[model samples]
Target: MSRILVVEDNIGIRNVLEKTLKMKGYDVFSVGTGENAVRLFTSDIFDLVITDLRLPKMDGLEVLKKVKKISSTTIVIIMTAYGTIENAIEAMKSGAYDYILKPFSLEEIEIKVEKALSQQRISNENIILKEEIKSRFGWITGKSQKAQKVYKFIKKVSDRPTPVLILGESGTGKELVAREIHENSSRRNFPFVAVNCAALAEGVLESELFGHERGAFTGAHAQKKGRFEIADKGTLFLDEIGDLPLNTQVKLLRFLQEKSFERVGGTNTLKVDARIIAATNKDLKEAIKNKSFREDLFYRLNVITMTLPPLRERREDIPELIDHFWSRYTKELHKDMAITPEVKDILYSYDWPGNIRELENAIERIIVLSEDKVVSIDDLPMELREGISDIIPKALPDNIGFTERVEYFERDIIKQALEKCSYNQIKTSERLKLNRGTLQYKMKKYNLYCKKISTKS
Candidate 1:
C-alpha cells in the first residue's frame, strides 16, 4: 500500500481528506502543520504529501522544499483556494506534483492522489531496474592481476565526477565496465545514455551529442535531446570515442571545460551536469598523432584511463565466465543445459579474439540449439572447435556392461570436479550442475572421497 500524508490546517478538511483517502486504500497520516509533516517524514517515509498552501507556521511551499530535500523522488501535492492559485503554480515550480483547489470533491481528492501515487510507483520501479542493472553487468570477476586493478579503480572513482576514458580492443567489455561504474555511482538512479561516436556522420554525431532543434537540419522534424541533456545528473558514455570527427571533438572539449552547450540551431547557452565516460577500440594516442583525434579533448577525457585486458590475457577466468553465461542462458531459455568436459576443454583452449562478448554469444548459441541437456564437443560451433585438432578419447578399462560404463564416466567427471573445487562438495555440485544430495549419493556409491584435498577457495 502507498503511504500518504495529509497536511491541512482546517481540522474538518483534514479529517474528510484523511477518511476519503483511507477509503481509497492508502496509508493516510494526517498533520495540521507542515512542521509536523516534516517531523513525521524524518522518522518515516511517505509516498506522497498533500498540504494546503496557507498554514499557521510553515507554508505548503516550504514543506514541499523540505520534503524534496529529505527525498528527491517523493511526490508533493499542494492544496490551495482560487485566491492562492498563483501560489499553487509557484508550488508546482518548487516541485509539487499537482495542486487541488479548496471546496474540492472527494472524487477530486481520489483522482489526484491516485495519479500522484501512480507516478511514484513508476519512479520506484526505475530505481529497482537500476539496481538489477548494477548486479547484472556490474560484476567483473577474474583472478588475473589486471582484472583486480580494474576493480580497484572502479571503487576509487565511482563517486567522483571525473572524466573516464576506457581503452580496450573490441568485445573487451569496455561498455560493461562503464555501466558498472555508473550503476555503482551516485547517479545510479539516473540515466546512463550511450552513443557510438563512430556510427554517425560528423554533423549527425554533433546533433546526437548536443541535441538539435526542430528545423535545425534536413530531417530534424522535431526537437530532440541529445545524449548529454538526456544524461544530465547521470552519465553519458561515448562509445568508440576515437572515431569522433575533429569538429565534434572540439565541442566535447568545450563541454568538458565549461559544462555548457547549445542546441544545433538555438543561441541560448544550456548547461547540464552529466559525467562523460568514453570507450574506444582504436588507439586514441595514435589517432592523435595521425591528426584524426584532438590532443586537447584526449587530455580532458583521459583524466582516469582504464584499459581492459583481452580475454586471452585472463585465460584462468574462461571456465568461470563460461559457467556464468551457461547458467544465464539456460535459465533464460528454459533449458537444462550442461557441457561435457571435452567441450569445456575446447572452449578454454581457444583464444577468444572477440573477448567476453564472443564467449558469451558462443555459450548462448550452444544452449539454444543443443538437442540434448548435455553439450558435447560435437555440439560446439564449428569455428570454435576448428582450432582443437581432436579431443582424444579418454582410455578406460573394458566395460562389462552399459551400466558399468555409465558409472565409470560419471565417477571420472565427478572426480575432476572435486579436484577443481578443492573437494568442496557444494562448489563441486554447483560447477557440475548437480544438486548437493545427488552428488553426495554418487560420491558414496563410487567411494570417491578425498581426505587429502583442502576445501578452500
Candidate 2:
C-alpha cells in the first residue's frame, strides 16, 4: 500500500482528510505541525506528503524543502486558503506536486491525491522497465562484489553530461557497458548511435562521423548527417576509439570541447548536444605513449572510465549466463532442449578466451543443431571437446584407489552439472542418469546442498 503523510494545523480538517484517505485503503499518517511532519518523515518512508501552506512553526514551503532533501522521490502537495494563491505558487516553485485550496470538497482532495499517486507509480514503473532492459541486453551480468562495484560506478557517471571511456579486452563487452550507461541516463529516450573506428579507413571514418555535403567527394552524391548529428540530444558510442586516426581525433576533440562541428566541404558549423561514450579494446595509455593517439583528445574522452572483467575471471557467472541464453534462444529457435551434465562439465573446465560473445554463439549453435530434447557432449563443437581433453592429465597417482578416484570425478561432474543447471534437481538428475532421490543423496553426501540454490523454477 502507498503511504501518505497529512500535515494540517486544523484538527477538524486533519481528521476528515485522514479518515477519508484511510477509508480509501491508503496507509495514512496525520500530524498537526510542520515540525512533526518533518520528524515523521525522517523516521519512516512516506510515498506522498500533503501539507498546509500556513503552519505554526515551519511553513509548508519549508517542510517541502526539508522532505525533498530527505528523499527527492517523495511526492509533496501543498494546501492553502483562498487568499494565499501567491504562497501556493511559491510552494510549487519549491517543488510541490500540486496545491489544494481551502473549503475544497473531500472528493476534490481525494481526486488530487489519486492523481499524484498515479503519477508517482508511473514514474517508478518507468524506472524499473529501464533497469530491466539494461540488464537484459547490456551484457554485463553478475551480482558479485566486483560486478556490483562496477554497476555502482556506472550509475554514478551515467547522469553526468560528459564523455565516458570504457577499457577492456576485445570480447569483454565494453560496448554493452556503454549501452547500459546510456540506457540508464537522461539520454535514454534519444538515439544511442555507435560507430566502429577500427573498421573504417581515415577518410571513410571522417566522412562517417562528420557527414559530407552533396558533391563534396567522389561518392558524396547526396548530403548526409554524421553520426554525431544523428545522435544530437542523445548519446554517440564510438567503438574502438583507440584506432581513430590522428587527424580525426583532433576533430573529435574539438567537438567534445565545444559541441560543434563542420561536415566535409561545408564551412558552416553544426552544433550538437550529444553525450560521447567511447570504448576501446586496445591499451590507450600505451597508444598515447607511442604517439599513435592524441593525448588531448584522450583526456577529454576519459572523463569517466569503466573496465569490464573478462569471462575467464568471472567463471562463476557462466552458469547463470547459460541459463539466461537458454531462456532467450529456446524461444527464438522453438526448442525445448537443455544442456546435459557432460556438456556443462566441459564448458566450466574450459577457459573462455572469447568471453561472453563466444559463449552466446556456442549456445545458439547448440540450440540450432541439437536434435534431441537435451544437449550432450556430442552437440558441442569439436574444438571445445578437444580443449577439455587437452587440459586433463591422463595418469593418476598409483597410491590412489581406482574407486576413490572415480568417486572424485563423479563429484566434480555432478557439481559442474548442478551449477550449469542452476541447481534444478530434476534436470540435474536427468542429465546424470540418477533418480531425483539418488541425486539428492549424493548432493548431501558431497555437501553441495549447503550452497544456496535459486528457486526460480
Candidate 3:
C-alpha cells in the first residue's frame, strides 16, 4: 500500500485530508506543523507528502527541500490558497510533483495522488528493466575479486557524463561493458550507435563518424547523418579506437571537446548532445609514444578508464561462464544436453585466448554438432581433448564407482577412435572392427555422435 503524509496547520483541513486519504485505502499520517512533518519523514519512508504552503514552525518549501535531500525519489505535493499561488509555483520549480489549490474537492485530491503514484510506478519499472538488461548483457557475472571490482567501478561511473575508454584485449567484452553503462544511465532510452574504426578506410570512417552529403564521395547518393547525430542524447561507441587515423582522431577530439560537428562536404555546423565511449585492444600509451595516437585526444577520451582482465587471469570464472553459455545455447538450439565431468575438467583447465567469445563459440559448436542429449569428451574439439589428456592423470581413483569407470572407459575409447578416423562414423566403425549396427548401438548407448562443426571463418 502507498503511504502518504499530510501536513497542514489547520486542524479541520488536516482531519479532512486524513479521512479522505484513509477512505481511498491509503495509510495516511497527519501532522499540524512542518517541523513534525520533517521529524516523521526523517524517521520513516513516505511515498508522497502533501503539505500546506504556510506553516508555523517551518514552511512547505523548506520541507520539500529537506525531504528531497533525504531522498530525491520521494514525491512532494504543495497545497496553497488563492493568494499564495505564486508560492505553489515556486514549490513546483523546487521539485514539487503537483500543486492543489485551497477548496479542492476530494475527487481532485484523489486524481492528483493517483497521477503522481502512477508516474512513480513507471519510473520504478524502468529501473528494474535496466537492471535486467545489464544482467543479460554479461555485466553481472561471477564473484571473483576482479569481476567485483569491475562491477563496482561500472556502478560508480555509469551515471556520470564523462567519456570512458575501455582498454582490454579483443573479445574481453569491452563493448558489453560500454553497453551496460549506457543502459544504466539516464540516456538509455535513446539510440546506442557503434562504429568499427578499424574496419573502414580513413575517408569512409570519417564520413561514417560525421556523416556525408550527396556527391561527397564516389558512392555518395544522398545526404546522411553520422553516428554522432544518430546517437544524440544517447551513446556513441567507437570500437578499435586505436586504429583511427590521425586526421580522424583530430575530428573526434574536436567533437568531444565541443559537442558540435559538420557533415562531410557540408558547410553547416550541427550540434549533438551525445556521450562518447571508445574501446581498443592496442597499447594506446605505446601508440602515443610512437606518435601514431594523439596525446591530447587520449587525455580527452581517457577521462574514465576500465581495463578488463583476460580469461586466463580469471580462470575461476570460466566454469560459471560455461554454465551461463550452456543454458543460453541449450535453449536456443532446442536441445536438452548434459556435459560430463571430464568435459568440465577440460573446459575449466584450458587457457581461453579468445576469452568469453571463444568459450561461447565452443559451447555453441557442441550444441550444433552433438546429436545426443548428453555431451561427452568426444563432443569436444580435438585441441581441448588433447590439452585435457596431457594435463589430467589417467589412473582411475578408488573414489570412482564401477558403473562410472565403465562409462569413462567406453567414452574414452569412442573419443580416441573418432579422433583417429577424423570424426567419420563409418570409418571409425571399420577401424574399430565392429559391425555398423553395433557401432550405432554403442554410440547411442554412450550418447556420442560424429557431427561436424560449421561456422564462418
**Per-model TM-score on C-alpha atoms:** 0.59, 0.59, 0.59
Model 3: per-residue lDDT, tens digit, 1-457? 9999999999998999999999999999999998999999999999999999999869999999999999899999999999999999999999999999988998999999999999999998888666545544354777778888888887888889999999987778888888888877899889989899999999989999999999988889999999999999999999999999999998899998888889999999999999999999999999999999999999999989999998877766877888888887897788999987778878986787887778878988999999998898889988787776654547799999999998888777777777656778887887567888888888888878766688969
Q: Write the per-residue lDDT of candidate 2 for residues 136-181, one digit (tens) a residue.
A: 4326567555577778988899999978988877777777788888
Give the Cα-based TM-score of candidate 2 against the true structure. Answer: 0.59
What's the residue-level lDDT of 199 in candidate 1?
A: 88
**Could you tell me the TM-score of candidate 3?**
0.59
392 Cα displacement, candidate 2 (Å): 7.9
Tens digits of lDDT, candidate 1, 1-457: 8999999999999999899889888899999998999999999999889999999889999999999999998899999999999999999998999998888898988998888888878887887666445434324657667778888888888999999999988888788789988977999889999998878998888998899999998999999988899999999999999888888888899999999999998788999999999999989889989999999898899889988889888777888788877877887798987788788878886788888888888888899888997898778898986765533336667746888777777887788778767899998997678999999999999998987667888
Weakest ten-residue segment in model 1 by summed lDDT: 131-140
How much does each candidate deviate from the true structure in C-alpha RMSD?
A: 12.6, 14.3, 15.0
* Local distance difference test scores for all models: 0.86, 0.86, 0.88
Best by lDDT: 3
Q: What is the lDDT of residue 340 in candidate 1?
A: 86
lDDT of 1 at 156: 89
